[model samples]
Target: MNNQHKPLQNGLHVVVVGAGIGGLACAIACRRANPPLPVTVVERAPEILTIGAGIHIPPNACRVVSSLGLLDKLKQAGGYQVKGFTLRRYQNGNVLVEKPMGMRMKTEYGAEWLAIHRGDYQGVLLEAAREAGADILTNAEVIGIAEGIGESFGKHMVVLKDGKSLVADVVVGADGLWSGVRELVLGRSFPPVETGDLAYRGTFTREHLKSFKNERIDQLMEAENVQVWLGPGRHAVFYPLRNKTEYNLVLLVGDDLPEGVRTSQGSLEEMAANFEGWDPILNTIISCLKSALKWKLLHFKELDQWTKGVIALLGDASHPTLPYQGQGAAMAVEDGAILALLLSRLQNQGISDVPDQRNQQLSDLLLLYQDLRKRRTEVNVAGAVDTRHYYHLSDGDEQICRDKELASLPDSAWQGPCSFNWGDAEYQKSLLGFDGLADAERTFDEWSRKKSRQANI
Candidate 1:
C-alpha cells in the first residue's frame, strides 16, 4: 500500500472510473490543475467505441470545452456550429418559435452553441485527457470500492473485475446512470427508473437523403438550423452535421420498453408509426432513416449526497435527468470543471503541518465540490422534468398558452401579456451565461475565508 501521509502534490492519485465524457473531462481538468495531479481513468469497455448519436453543446458547455483547448479539434471532427433552433407544430410543421444560436448566443453568452456527434465529442475529450497526462486504462471494470483506514488518510481502494486492486487518494465515479460506484458510496443498490420515454436516433449522409427526391427534404438539408417538432406526448429534434454532409434525427415518445435495456434495433416503420399524422416533411426524413436505435430514457432521483469521504460522483452517476432541456452532458461537463477547480484550490493551499489537518482539508475540498454542484444540478434535474411535461402537453388551454408563449419569441419583440416566454431573458441568462468554474472559485474563496476566521477563534 502507498503511504497515506504523502503530500498531495507528490502522492495524491485520482482514480476516475468510466472513460466517458464526464470521466475524461474530470481526468483532464485534474491533471491540468496547478501543480498537476496524477489521474487514471478506467473503462469497462474493451475498446473505446463510438456510442450514441448527436449532442447539443450549449454555450455554457462550449466555454468549458474551449477552455480545454478542444474547440478547434471538435470542429475538425465535424461539429456543426448551431445557428438557431426552430420549434414547429408536429401537425403541419408550422414554425411556432425561432431562436438564434450562433453569433447571437456568442454575443450574449461569450460562446457559440455547437451540435456534434457524441462520438466526436467524446473522442476530443479523451484525446485531450490523454495529452493532459491522464493514464487511461480500458476494459478495467470496477466491482467494489472500500474506504481507506484513518480519518486523516484520504485514501480509497478500488477493486476491478480482473481481481486487481488500485488505491488512490480520491475516487470519482462517472460511470453513467447505472454506476456501480454510486451503489458502493450509498451502501446499497440505487437503480435508475424508466421515465416512460423512448428515443429513436439515427444519422444519415446528404447523399442518401438526396436519393429521396423531395424538395422539402432538400430544403431542410440545406438549412443550417436545429429543428424541433413538438406535440402531445412526443417531440422530434433534427440538425445538420459535418458541414451539412450528414444530419442527425431524434424522436422521443411515450413507451413501455423493458427496464435496464439501453437500446435496441428499431424499424423505420415503427418510427413512422409513432408520428403517423405529423408533417409530410417529417415523414420524408423518417423514410430516409435507414436503421434506427431506440433507447429507453431513464431518470435517477436526485441523490441526497454525491460524495462520501474521499470518494465522489460526477455526471450521470450523480444526477441523471431527462433529455428535454438538452443539458445532461452540459451539466456533467460543468461538474468536471467545478470539481477540478475545487481540487486545484486544495493543491494551492499546500500540504498542512499536521497529517490530520491535511486529511480534513481533502475532505473539506470534496464537500465544497458537492456544495457547489448539488443545488444547481438538482434544480436542473427538476427543470428537465418540468420541460418534459411542458413539451408534451395535451391539446388543452395549457397547450394553447404554451403555443402563445412560444409564438412570442425574440422575447424582446413581444409586448403582449404572456405569462410565459420560451427562451426568455432570465432563462437565457441562467442557462447560457452560467460559468461553473467562476462560480466554484467564488464559493470556495468565501468558504476558505470562513474557515480561516473560525480557526483564529
Candidate 2:
C-alpha cells in the first residue's frame, strides 16, 4: 500500500486496475466527467517504463483520444501522420493495394490517422491521467476482488498483494491479457489461448539503413507512408516513428517457439530467413535490427458477460484480439472511452439517489456497455482473422485472385461486405469511420428515457 496517499470515499469511486493505455484512458475520462468521478489506477509495475515499439491510431481511436484531450499532446510527441499504406508483393515488391490515409482520411473519416511510438503514446496518456486528478498507485498488484459481497456489497473489496484492501463503487478491469480480475469475474481461471502465430517486432534508427535502399524504399521513406508486405504464411508492416528518425517493423509468422514459451529473444538471422527472397529494402531494414522480441498472438473466447454486479471488464480483460488489424490497443481505448462515458453519467445521482436506483442504473449501463461493445469488438476481431487469411495467402490461384480483388476494389468507403481484406471499402469504413463513444451516448440516453417511463419516477 502507498501510505503517502489516501483514497476518496464517495459515490462511484472507480478502481481501474492496470495503468496501461486502457486503464489510463478510463481513469482520465472518468476524472474529466461532468461532475468528475474519483478514479484510482492500480498498476503492478513499480514505475511506468517508456516501453514498446510502434502503434497505429486509426481515425476511430483518434476520436476517442481527442475526447481524452491528448490528441495535441500525441501530435507534439512526434506522431507521424501516415499518408497511407501500400500493400506489396513480398518477392518482387509489386504494388498490390494502395489507398490514401492521413489528411485524406480526415476528410473521409473526420480524424487523421496517426502512427506513433507506443512508449511515447503511453507516456502522454499517463501524464494526462495524473494531471486529471487520478490517484495512481504503482506496484499495487490485485490478488483478488469480491463484488457485491459482505459489507462491501454494492461496493467491492479489491485485495492487494500487500494485504491492503480498496473499497470501490465499481471495479474496472483494464488489466492486460493475463488478467487476475478476469479470473475473478469468471469464477475460475481462464487464460488467453494462443493463435498458432508469433509476432517478431522491433525498431531501427534511420541512420542504420546503410545496408539497403531502392526505388521502393526511397519512395516509401520519403512519403512517410506505412508499408506492408503480404506473403506466403506471413505478413510484415513497417512505418516511420519519432518524426521519421526511427522505423518500426512488425512481422507475423507461424509460431515455432518452444511449446509453452510465449515470448523470447528473436534472432536477426531467423527474421531474415523468414522473409528470404522478399523486398531488399525490407531485408535491409531487418539487417539493421539490434534486438527483437517474439510474442505469441493470443485471444480469449467470448465470455458469458463482461459485467457482474459492480465489476466490469475492460480492454484485454474482456476481449483480447489478434494484431491482424492493428486494433488491439485501439479496441482497448475505445472500450475505456465508452465505458467511462456511461459510468460518468451516474454522477450526482450516486449521492442523492437511493442505493437501489444507483446500483440498478450502474448495472444496466455496464450490461449495456457489454452488449454494445461485444458485438463490435467481435466484428473487429473477426476482421483481423479475415485479414490474416488474405495477408498470409500462399502464392497461387487464390493469392492471384485476392490481389486482383484488391486492385479492383473501390477506394471510397462503401456499404456491404468487404471485397478484399486489405483496404476493403466497407471494412475500412467500419474500422475507421466509427464513433463508438457517440453511439454509446445516444443509446444511453434512450436507455435512460425507457427506464423513466417504465418506473414512472
Per-prediction TM-score? 0.93, 0.94
- Across 301-415, the per-residue lDDT of candidate 2 in tens digits comes to 8788888777899889888888877788899999998888888765643433555656667777789889889998888888888888888989899988888777765443423
Which residue pairs of candidate 1 clash? none
* Candidate 2 lDDT for residue 322: 82
- C-alpha RMSD by candidate, in order: 2.8, 2.4
User: After aligning candidate 1 to the native by TM-score, how far in Å is the CA of 204 from where it should be?
Assistant: 0.9
Please give the distance, in angstroms, between residue 308's alpha carbon in candidate 2 and its true position after superposition: 1.0
TM-score of 2: 0.94
Candidate 2: give the clashing pairs: none
Q: Which stretches of candidate 2 lie over 4 Å from their true place?
A: 1-10, 147-154, 210-216, 348-357, 410-418
Residue 183 in model 2: lDDT: 86
Tens digit of per-residue lDDT, candidate 1, span 84-140 = 788889899999888777787788888889988898889888888989988888889
